[model samples]
Target chain A: MSFADVNIQFLEAAKYTLGLFFLTLLIAIPLGVVICACAMSRFRPVKWLANTFIWIIRGTPLMLQVIVVMYGPGLIFDVPMKNRFLAALIAFAINYAAYFAEIYRGGIMAMPKGQYEAGKVLGMSKASVNGLVIFPQVVKKITPAMGNEVITLVKDTSIANIIALPEIILTAKNIVATYAIIWPLFYTGVFYLLMSGVLTLFFKWLEKRTNYYKA
Target chain B: MAFYQVNNVYKNFGDVKVLKGINLELDEGQVLAIIGSSGSGKTTLLRCLNFLEIPDKADIYLKGENIFSIDNTDSAAASNADESNISEVENGKNIQTDSEKNQPTHAKKAKPEKISKEMRKLIDSKRGHFGMVFQSFNLFPHFNVLKNVTLAAKLKYDAHAPKGFARWSKEAKAARKQAMQEINEKAVALLERVGLGEKLNSYPCELSGGQQQRVAIARALILQPDILCFDEPTSALDPELTREVLKVIRDLKKDGHTMIVVTHEMQFAKKVADKVIFMADGIVEEEGTPQQVFEHPVSEKTKAFLAESEKSIDEE
Candidate 1:
């Protein structure tokens, strides 16, 4: 495919593509935090709820999840999830939240128990100490893990094509269908490759800034 | 505490009872050393006085008030005082209504919930009016020495932080700063006290075991706690390092910081201990002044344990 052809298709899908990446981020960041808190909760009910959600999401295929979102709401409640793109976005958001939650939980648990005891001994309330002291350390410890999830989120944006939402991969597919060529599909990799490359570099900056959190 | 006491304390981890019925007391200014064999539960007993180990149905007190007793008197008093104040305010009292006065206010109901949460936090912080110095020197590895010492001061003293020239009071900002400075100075006096004045800025990873213990000693002493508990503060060091840390404790004795030390240094305990507790299998086998217990141990367990320790030391 010519550069002109590829650019137009890329631009066409760019609207849906941008919506998925940022929208999923908005949903996942908060849901991920809650899911992480649930997993860490001492109550068995909370832990089980969080773990079961994570297990089911992780166990199933993303394509199946997209199909479920597209039709399941309409089937169960007679509320049509009118836009397949919105269905695609919701499915991807929930799926990646479960993944990001694990990343967060892993980071928090790996912190030394001594830090919490030190906080207590120094007269810190459990909530204040964890927020001001432990959370910063957790953020630092989890930066690499979080970075991996974020970069993967960028690549996984391609999965929106499963619900035919016209993200970069589907944009490339439509170009192939319109013009009988495969080059645009190959060039789609470049968008992901460049975006992922940029994300990896950004995390390196985050890691350096957070180097103060020692074990 | 008006005076610190450990009375008839007993503890066991599963079947292995570590402390049998034990009774002891320290006046506000005296230092007491507990010397015993490893696994003798000296640390366990020291922790009990602080209610660190909640006995499986036993009593521990500070200033003679049952600390482990869960009657909720402190919290209840707080809530009652608050309720009376609210009722008084509702009936027209002089208290400035919280800034949200214009709202019909969920807060009269919410205030009790909020205050109780705050009260629980306050009570927990109050527990550490006495400080702990671990053998490993559990300094916040993330912060500098200055930040570690000032941390409590910063959080406790500063009520409302603002912005601009007074965005935060430099003094308020330096509540921690001043605590760090005074801590640094006292720590220096303590380092000079234990002779580590030159090593103030040093991190724990960079210091020798003896030096780290000295820093731990300085950290605990900086608070001027009613009683300072040592969990084998020098036991981790080599002989040379052990002497270095011991010299610091000796200086603490001179300075009059009340201390409950868990030690294996028999000679050190013999020299300075006003009371000696010989613990075996968690019960106090026998306890008295170092003179009474060391020179003429009454229990066979105490006698054999001391003799065996002396023999081992002599061989070493």
Candidate 2:
């Protein structure tokens, strides 16, 4: 009921929001590269499977995916689903990885064929060409697009609320219902604004550093 | 046998025949200039030499060794050629015992012996013997001038380093450091030779087009390729920049470095070439000395191409 109490409660809830954001990024970014590789694999079946999975994930809503992930196993397999946070994390990671994978694929495909030819002429193996020559350029290219996805992800962490995970937005909603006061819900916007602003500056700095070597 | 030989090389892209049984030869320290118009397949031939494009049918020899051969007429024969090449090396009956073969055989035998292993080694060393420069320069944009020149050489050294020691062992680390120092020194000398000593720290984007191409030349030279192949090295540059690149190539010629240049620069070709080849419609229309080709071309196609090239030069 007190402002200090409300602040403490929001701060506790902020931990979950921040946890989901960082953990999802940690899992998704590298997973995206793996998925991108699968989608670009020379083998037709692998490419098709990866592409189909990406299509399904991107086409469906994150909120719906969260609910399905949290409850699907219990209904489909008749098993008890106890870990709500784990289910939400899985849904968020898989969904974001698909978007990130497409961003990576786009960046890689945009590279000039001459780059590969140049590497071949230098007697570099295909692995060396991808790791040394192509990947760095791809990273530079995908930075802005990746930044946009990351910003979207910050807000998307709120979708975990559908699974009743105690992230900041869900906690704020609980406070609103319990106290019949609306200000706590509005106060959650301040946390999101501050988090996204830091991320914007961080991405700007990253883009500048990578620009030291122009693609 | 010639130091480098392209025997009846043929390549087709889809239904379009790009190279029609082209035959050519070059001795050591000779520059063979290939002159042709667009779609003449000169670039494709150069690509084939670099192994960037696999010819549908071909035999490529470097330094009297059959480095590449494909008998697309029969897939079985093509594979047999590869198998024979590998068996020759494995049996130690190979004529040329290069540094690659000097490695301990028992150490090599430790891995599950696949035919690809021997074939890859042969192709890798053979490919290393020729350095290629592209029309666009194709310098690694993410690396600086020095790094661009040194990267491939460093990768090669690391790859061919002795096999037994753990990668993080003291001896391995020390060997790596020493090798890196030597490669860096050679790279510096090469960049200086190409008139780019001052731009070692500069990235590809920071340099002029000519400077970038010169960096490319330095990068190529660092490998100590037996023959350097230039695929229209100056085509992307303006007249002034072209002169600078031509000067570097001329200097390389004076140093007795063997080269294959694909170019439309008639005057440069005439001045720097030991042998001149006029290609039209994916076949050699004329092959002779520069004087013979330029002054007295045998084929009508060669004569018309020369005249057209001269007119373009005059207009420029």
Candidate 3:
């Protein structure tokens, strides 16, 4: 393949990689928030279930999780798994939500207990206390950690190759093997580096935007 | 009739009885100053009144309306109140009246009475009746002076506004705008009145402790609470800063705002409070006019606390 052809192919694969990244985040971030609420729930069984889910996801490797999520149901229940991309997407979302939920819990717990009391005395309901008073501060707090997870997600998209999904790395590997060349593989690193760099800048801007609270 | 009444208020935290059967009443414009050392349950008492620390057993009436009930009907709670007082369920759902008073039942039966929607609305509305200022001046660190003051007012308006008034209808939008304009005006006037007009745009962290406490005062006042509770509002500040906050509170007294101030500043209490309650060991040891409590305390606990507090002030 020509260098131009190689670049175009990599770009097409990059689109898939980026799609995976955004979609995983779309599902994971909100699910992480729900899990965070559950982790802090007053009901014992709910909190236990949420904590167990987080523990299992965090304790296992992403590669192992991807394999299990993709094939476990099909193998165990006599149902063949279809939609390779959807399986990988679900695996990524579940894995990331655990980490994101941990970060959220930490950020929320770091806030002084008095903040809730103050909100209550101001006549805010329990739900509004979390929504209006607590969540904003938690977002500011978890941004740096969140940025780290997001950047990791950008790189970890390559893990989809475990399921033989043609993400950026797999595409580059195929190109190198066909053309008997090695440059495309190195070029794949450039896309990830650039994406991570942009995300770092975005998160820095976010931190500055929310730097209203101080000692 | 009293504007606010707290009857037999009791609170327990894991077997530690923090507040034991405290009863108090406040007429309109009456300023009650609660003075006590740490762990005296003065703060807990204030928290219970606002339902911040849900009392194990209590009856709080605002303008003769049962503030805890969901329907705002005194009769719903009034009928339940006579039901053996066997410490009914926390949510008032199971308030069982025991007819077998003489037959000592091994277990108490709970009669399910779901609190009505109207009563929930009433309870929420009545929450605006008492505003509390904490010792740490717990201002929302994320919001600026203006936002802090305006937020509660905005919330109160949203909670009580006509349905769909928050929507996009022209009439709804106009009414919302008018309501917001009024709230904003009230907030501004309150901040200005608290002498924080210049700091409206400043974040809580950017302001001094005294300034932050003043902002908190302004935020509470925006709710137009019938009574304001100050839980050592100046405790975090230096004497100089404390003076500034106390001055603002003193002005509130002059304006005839009903207040319950918990403080270590005996001089401020003597100057500002209409009724001084000296609490010790989870109960009111002595309560009377400032002169009666400070000059001639009836209880030994009150006299000792006063002397020790005076010594600390002297050392300072």
Candidate 4:
């Protein structure tokens, strides 16, 4: 193969990695907050339901959840599932939402209860407590957890290839299988390491910004 | 109606009885002080006001209406079962949301419309009408002073309590606007009152303990609440810093605002207290004018308390 073809292949793989990283984030942050509300809701059933979902998600492999979400409707109900990209998105959204929910819950619960009562006597309601009193505090509390999840998500998205959704690792593996070369596989690590490193730096910056909450 | 009254309140956690037949009362324009040693249920008594934890048995009144009704042991379990069963039986009859489980309990007791609605109406009235401060300043760590002060205006004062009520109407817009204005003007004024006018934009950590407590005071007072409860607001401060906070409380008293303060400052209590209550073992052991309680203690507990607190301050 020409050197130019190998360069193009690397570019193609970079596009896939970048796409998955952005897509997961675009879906995860808000969805994680929603999951957090469900998990830590004042309402009992909602909390129980959210806890059950997290328990199931954490207990099982992400690989299995990916397959089930991607293929379950078609396999179980004898109906065609949506496009592979959409299935992958749903699987990723749901799986990460559960993980994010736990991060949020942990962050929120870690805060002193006095903060909440303080919010209350401040005449803030539960929702206001969440938005004004709690959410920002939780954000500070969860930055590390969120940072970890986001980094892990960068690597986990490669599971898209199980159903042939064509992410970075898939791009690398396919090229290596055909060309009798392992450079693409090793090149895949560059994308992950770079993304993870950037996220780590971003989180450190966020932590520095949130240091006012140290009290 | 006195703004609030807690009559014959009882609270027990497992085998431990925290508050036994406690009585507390606050009127529209009075400063009632609850002073005691630690673990005396002073905090628990404060918690009961908002139903954060209900009394095991009691009659609580707000605005002359009965707001708290304790359960008889026989009916407590029965009522709990009936509510759960009613929902379980009705679960198949209609759509259900995940949050239905924590819906206000009054809905299950009387007519779905009458009693529960009245109960909610009563609870909603309490919102914004009263405010509390803690021993620890408990300021929102993430937000600046202005946003923290503005929270009641944007969220709770304008928002209804005992939520899940139907939406307010177009006619209610004026009330909403009025509430908004009250929250804004009053919060800003309160910040000024607490000497935090310039620091409105500052975050909690940027301030000293005295400054943070001042901000917390503004955050509490913004709603124009009928009563402001300060739970040992100065305990966390040094003696010099405590003087700054006491000045603010003194100003509030000068303005004729009612208060229920749990304080360790005997001098402040003696000076500003219209009535001083000595709480011990979750109940009032002694209560009278500050002079009567402080200078002439009636109970052994009160005598011991005055002796200990007075000695420590002088030693320093």
Candidate 5:
């Protein structure tokens, strides 16, 4: 393949990688927040359910989770999986949300109880206390941990190739197979590196932005 | 005829009796200071008044309105001691005739409704009526000093504003702007009053212990509460800082604000308090005017505690 052809092809595949990454984050972060809230819920049954879900997701490997999520319905229920993109998206979102929920729980748990008490004594409603005082501090605390997970997510997108979902690495492998060119396969590393580098920069900016809250 | 009364208050924390049948009456513009050794239930009593620590049974009455009774407006219905209500006082001291004395405590009436759950919530929303300053200050560390002082006031205003007024009406928006201007101006003045005007932009962590406590005091005062409760507000401060905080509190006393202060500062207590309550274990051991309590304490427990406290001061 010509250099320009390689660029155009890689860019087209980059779209899928970025789409999976963004969609997973868009779905997972809010899902993670809800899960974290449930995990810390006052209701014992809800808390237990959330904890059990987190334990199951965390104990198993993400690769295995992705495989099972993509194929488990087809294998167990005898229902053929319809959409490859939807399968990949569901697998990634579920796996990442579990990890993100734990990070959120840690952030929420680390805050001083005095913050809530102070908010209450000032006549703030329970919801207002969480939104105005507690969540901002939690967000500041979880940023570094979240940044690490996000960087890992960039690389984990490559695992989608196991199910023939053509993201960046799969496209590279296709090029190597068709044209018998070894260079494009190595060029794929550059794409992952650049994506992670940009994400690292973005996360660094986020951490700085939240520097106003000191513990 | 008292402005406020904590009648037959009791609290237990998992079998440990923290407050046992505590009773006291407070007058308007009176500053009552509570003093005791550690674990003496002074803080618990303050918390009970604010409903921060829900007492097992407390009949808190403000201007003869049973604040913990369900229907405070009906004097006939106020016989159900445990029911609660929110009484918003607006410049009138329409002293209801004291009917509580005539109602026999043992008179068998239909069982009072178990309204503690609903009353707990009702009392909680009325907590703004009692501003509290903790020993540790407990200022929101995430907020700057100005935000810390203004936060509760703004939220309270927002909460009490007619529902959806801010979102739907131009008139409401104009009113809100005017209200916000007044809040900010009042907040600035409060910060200034606490000697923290120059530190308005400083974060809680950036301020010293005394400065943070002053900010906390300002935060509490912004609500313009009916009563200000201090849980050893200067306990965490050094002597210099303690003096600064005490000076501010003294100024508040001069301003005729009703206050309930729990303090180890006996001199400050004696100087500022209209009534001094000396508590030991879980009950009031002795209480009187500051002169009688400090100079002629009736109980051995009060006398001993005062002597020990004075010895500690001498050692310092």
Candidate 6:
């Protein structure tokens, strides 16, 4: 195959990889906050249920979780597996949301009690206290941790290949088989590197912006 | 009626009784300084007044309005208070209750009432009556000095704005913009009063401890509270910084602001306080004019505390 053909194939596959990454993040970030709230809920049953879900998702490997999400339903329930990409997206989002929830909880719990008291004494309502005073500080704290997960997610998108989602790695491997060349496989590293490098810079800028406030 | 009155307030943390049947009354334009060693519940008392820590039983009146009252019918808590009192006496800590002597009997028989949502909302609304300055100067770190001072005021204004008009209406938007301008002006004036006129854009992290505390003071003052309570306002500052914050506080006193200051600065207490209270082991050991408390303390506990404080000052 010509370099142009390989480049075209890799670029098309990169679209899938980028879509999965962005969509998973778009869903997971907000879902993580919801899960974190449930985990931290004053209601005992809700807290336990959220914590158990987080525990199972986090304790297992992502590849296994994805496989289970993709195949387990059809195998056990005898339901036909429909959208492979959607299944992978669901698995990735659920897995990452669990991790993000813990990071969020850690950030929030690490906050000084004085922050809440400061808001209370200011006559702010409870919702306003958390929304204005607490969450902004929590975001600053969770940024570095969230950034780490995001970079990991960039590479983890390749795991969708197991479900034959035809992402970048799968396309590169197909080229390796057809053209009997290996560099296309190695060339895929450039895409991951560029994406992660940009993310690293973005996170660094975010950290710097939030550096205006110190805990 | 007193401008602010804390009647028969009691607070407990599990088995530990923090404030036991404390009663304090302050009139308008008066500064009451509460002096005590650590764990004497002075800070807890201030927290109770600010509603940061809800009292188990308290009748808090602001401008003769009963802003917060909880009747703890939990007989268990009353007995727990008594037990803690015995433990305090056994520890050889004086259990003086000159003001609280009659409160226990009254509190034990009261019916237990939970802090209902309505009551909490009421207390939250009434919280504007008291402004609190914490020892740590808990200014919102994410906000600049001016933003920190103006934030609560703006929130209050937005909450109370007329709801008849749509938020997007020109009249409503104009009113909001004008209100914001006024809040900013008031904040700038208060910051300037606290000697932070030039640091209005600076974040809390960029300022020194003294400057942060002053910002906290400005933040509190902008709310126009009926009373300002300082919980060891200068305890976290260096001596020089302490003097700077105390100077602002002294200036506020001269401006006729009523304040309750829980502090360890004996000299400042003596000089600035209209009334001095000495608390020990969750009770007021002595309360009087500065001359009476500092110069002629009646209780042995107060005398020992003052002497120790003076010796520490001398050594420093």
Question: Which candidate tops lDDT?
Answer: 6
What does candidate 2 score in Cα RMSD to the true structure? Answer: 6.9
Q: What is the C-alpha lDDT of each candidate?
A: 0.69, 0.86, 0.82, 0.74, 0.83, 0.86
What TM-score does chain B alone reach in each candidate, compared with the true chain B? 0.72, 0.84, 0.82, 0.76, 0.83, 0.86
lDDT winner between candidates 4 and 5: 5
lDDT tens digits by residue: candidate 1, A1-215: 67986888787777787778889989988899999889877577998999999999999998899889998989999998889778988998899889989988887767665566556555666676778777877788888888888888888778878777878898888878988987888888887888789889999999997665345
Interface RMSD of 2: 9.6
Q: What's the fnat for candidate 3, on a 0 to 1 scale?
A: 0.66
Q: Chain B TM-score in candidate 2, rounded to 2 decimals?
A: 0.84
Give candidate 2's whole-model lDDT.
0.86
List DockQ for all candidates: 0.28, 0.44, 0.42, 0.45, 0.34, 0.48
The CA lDDT at B148 in model 4 is 80
Q: TM-score for each prediction?
A: 0.78, 0.90, 0.86, 0.78, 0.86, 0.90
Q: Tens-digit lDDT track for model 2 on A20-100?
A: 899999999999989999998757799899999999999999999999989999999998579988898899999999999
Clashing pairs in 5: B68-B83, B68-B84, B69-B83, B69-B84, B70-B83, B70-B84
Expressed as tens digits, the lDDT of each residue in B1-316 for candidate 5 is 6898888777665556778888998999999999999989998888778766555566777877766632222342454345433343211112322221112122114222233434546777678679999988889988999999888888877877878634558887888889889988999999999898899898998989999999999999999899999999998989999999999999998898999999999999999999999999989999999999999988999888888876854575
How many clashes (backbone N, Cα, C below 3 Å) per candidate? Answer: 10, 0, 3, 0, 6, 1
Model 5 Cα interface RMS deviation (Å) = 10.5
Model 1: per-residue Cα lDDT over B1-316, one tens digit each: 4477666666555455666767777766566778767777777776555544433324445676654432122343466565654321122122222221111122223221112333344346456657777776777655655455556655654433554667466665666466556645654565566666666566556667787677666666655666777777777789999898887777777777677878888888888767777777777777788899899888998888788887854585
Candidate 4 chain A has its poorest 10 consecutive residues by lDDT at A117-126
Per-residue lDDT of B236 in model 3: 91
Position B163, candidate 5: lDDT? 85
Candidate 6, residue A24: how far the Cα is off, in Å? 1.0
Candidate 1 chain B weakest ten by summed lDDT: B99-108
Error of 6 at B273 (Å): 0.4
Residues B1-316 of candidate 4: C-alpha lDDT, one tens digit per residue: 5677878777665456778778877777788888999989887777666544445566767688665565433355466654655321112212222322222332223221212333333444555656888888888777788888887666754556233333355546666777777777777788998888888778888899999999888887766776788888999999989999999999899898988888888889999889989999978999999989988998999998888886856575
